[model samples]
Target chain A: MTIDKKLNGTSLVIALEGRLDTMTSPQLEEELKTSLEGITDLTFDFEKLEYISSAGLRVLLYAQKVMNKQGSMKVIHASEPVLDVFDVTGFVDILTIE
Target chain B: MMTLTVKAHISNLSMVQDALGEWLDSIGCPMKTSLQLQMAVEELFVNVASYAYGEEEGDLTLSYEYEEELSLVRITFRDQGMPFNPAECLEQEEESTRLHVEDRGVGGLGILMVYKTADQVHYSYRDGWNILILEKKL
Candidate 1:
């Protein structure tokens, strides 16, 4: 997946494209790990993301846990497939999505 | 109905998903059903690829079938690497939900999605093959 990062004040926006699965989740994890410093609001733009698998969800879960300690996180513009995955896994209850 | 055998590796995930996705699409599977199937397929296949062989490579056979009478789609995954039952793991994950979010690890969520999304799930070991059968209503 292609991850585009944009920093604005204390909010950070990361836009993702392509598929997020086992092969690509580590990339996102590293990206979030290094970029989350001093940020209080994290937003994920999934408008271009094709789909997400459980591995991808795992990364998000970890990111959420990390963000929980420092700030807040939200996912926006998720594709239908991604949203369905979130729904099936009950991530809708755990993660803030728009 | 179709059966496909591929190397049990993470890199082959999209290839399997694409093949199954096309077939499901051709059969006019609903978007919701197809998405759920895709999720379960990835989780189960990834599990096999990651843990079944224990640092060795193996082959996994996936058989896809649709029962018109029941309007159900079934996918059976078979591998000879190890006799692992995902249903048992799912049971453990169900009970682990009591743990706090901070204490929760991300490992078992995949199998949990398999159990949540698949309408019927069965695990069996026969002929040295670990077979997992997952079905969803169309």
Candidate 2:
């Protein structure tokens, strides 16, 4: 998966492309670990993302937790399949989606 | 029925997905169903790779059969690793899903998803092989 980070002041928008599964979630996890130090707002742009498994959801949950204390995080432009995963996992209630 | 055997390693996830995706596409499986199947397969495969062998390398065999008449697909994962039944963890995971995000733990979510999305999930230990079968109606 390709993770593109755009930092405008304190807001960080990370766009993802391709599958986010067990093999790829760690990459995003590591990226967030290093990039989320001072960010006040975070956005996950899933416009180009193709798929997401539980591993991806885990990372999202982790990010949400981190941002909960620091700022706010939301997911935007998620595809139907990706949305379905969030819905099935009940993450729709926990994470902000747009 | 088609089968593909590969090492139970995290790096082989794409290889497994590609082969299965190609077969699903050739069979005209709907995009939504294909994605769900792929997710379930990843969850199960990763489970085996992470926990089944316990630091030892092993092989995971993925066998799938499509029933054109009923529009059903049955996929099986067989591994010669430790005996673990994914289905047994469903109850606990289900409870965790209902908890608040702060209280929820990350473990077992994958297996919980496989159980929720797949039409049927069956597990068996036969002749020292851990066999898991997932059936989905396309």
After best superposition, candidate 2 residue A10: deviation in angstroms? 0.8
Task: Summarize candidate 2's per-residue lDDT along B16-85 as a digit string, tens digits.
Answer: 9999999999999999999999999999998998999999999999998999999999999999999999
| lDDT string, candidate 2, A4-97, tens digits | 9999999999999999988899999999999999999999999999999999998999999999999999999999999988887889899999
* Model 2 B-chain TM: 0.97
Clashes of 2: 0
Interface RMSD of each: 2.3, 1.0
**What shift in Å separates residue B89 of candidate 1 from its native position after superposition?**
0.7
List chain B TM-scores, each candidate: 0.95, 0.97
Give per-model CA RMSD. Answer: 2.0, 1.2
Cα lDDT, model 2, residue A60: 93
Question: Candidates' DockQ values?
Answer: 0.54, 0.76
Q: Model 1's lDDT to the true fold?
A: 0.87
Candidate 2 residue A65 Cα shift, in angstroms, is: 0.8
CAPRI verdict (incorrect, acceptable, medium, high) for model 2: medium
Q: Considering only chain A, what is the TM-score of each predicted structure? A: 0.96, 0.98
